[model samples]
Target: MTPPEPLRDVIARHGLQASKALGQNFILDRQLLARIAAIPGEIAGDTIYEVGPGPGGLTRALLDRGARVVAVERDPRFLPALAELGAEYPGMLEVIHADAMRIDEPALAGRGARVVSNLPYNVGTALLLRWLTADWPPWWQSLTLMFQKEVADRIVAPPGGGKFGRLSVLAQWRSHPSVAMQLSRSAFVPPPKVASSVVHIVPGNAPKDVAARSIEQVTEAAFGQRRKMLRSSLKSVPAALAALEPLGIDPQRRAETLAVADFVALARELG
Candidate 1:
């Protein structure tokens, strides 16, 4: 097989630089990118969806792992570099020049694919939330995504920690989320201001009786007033308030103290 051209050479050849406005921080380290690629293990035939594939660093890694990649990139500047990579591995890469947030992800990559990306910092959390709220046993088989460490902590945070809140509840309710790897700030080309980590999420069976929307409502109200007791914070959502009594949960408890299952039970009662 032909070797893919050097990524740095491709970038320089295309006169490309990471765009700060787009939250772009290109990961120039091939070994580190390979590690990110390995998170979706044994994915040879899987259609991997990658967002913001700046200069195709991780993209090449994914292709090297034998994944057929659908990479959605907003930055047109990196297209030529990506195209060069595509040529190296014929029919292995599909580069979409569009904003990931605006695209129909499931329609683009189809169902049961793994989503793996070094996501743009600005849209990372929002994108994760979007995927999380998708239909039970969501379209994607798994999410192996990079985010700022703080956000990664929030996603995998357990109850009682300061990082545990709405994101924690939602993420844990219908998925198994864990930190796959931590990356230093120096890993990127221009380097992001903060350290980053990869969070691997595999969808689990969602509570059949509860609406995902209801869970969002419950957590939003509960965490929106996190300092207040559940009785006070939940007053805004009568369903959640009503749930506490039936579930034998103390109304005086704060949001941070509730388990993910507790939130799911409350959401079940909300319907």
Candidate 2:
């Protein structure tokens, strides 16, 4: 059988261009996409939930790696191309025409599906927050997502760094997150102004007896006024402020100085 047309050829034939409004920047390099797909480890016959699969580039890579992909794409312009890909992959690819933000991922992808995507820049952080705050032992098995380098840094940042804030605490408190790979700005068709990185995250043991909301509440309050001392910043969350003393966290410390474990401890004390 003849080899399938290259992704660049498919994009050219279809006159498809990345839509700026949708935060689309198409990556035609199959090698890079394959590397990204590999970051989630072995996935033969596993279900992958992909968001913003513009022109089906990453979707194709995941399918090639023997994953069954359910792709959520909001841009109607790329659906035809994605449909063509679905035909090639038969039952392996399922395309959903809907905004990923509104999709109930657990209901759609079912429990324990791996979520892999080159997420749209505009909504990536919001989606990550949603996933991070989902019920304990979230529906997804793992998250392998591409984000702008700054956001990726925030996801994996450690305490005492400028990048360490609410995102760092939330991501680290319940999961192991790492920068799986970095991609240059020039890698995309319409290269983004900033470099990008893929973050690999697998769920870890959440602190027992601590509600996820309590952690979110504490982080939001603490980081909301990050420049201030914890006693001042956490004033809005009286419970968190009250718990700080009993937990032996210095009231004068800034939010960035506190570790993820400190935040979890505060949340546990909030209960």
Tens digit per residue, CA lDDT, model 1, 116-219: 99999989999999999988778999999999999999999999979999999889998999999998998888888899999999988877898989999999
Prediction RMSDs, each to the true structure = 1.2, 1.0
lDDT of 1 at 185: 91
Number of clashing residue pairs, candidate 1? 0
Judged by whole-model lDDT over C-alpha atoms, candidate 2 comes out at 0.93
TM-score of 2: 0.98
Largest TM-score belongs to which candidate?
2
User: After superposition, which runs of candidate 2 have C-alpha atoms over 4 Å from their true positions?
Assistant: none
Judge candidate 1 at residue 21 and give its lDDT: 84
Q: What lDDT score is found at residue 219 in candidate 2?
A: 95
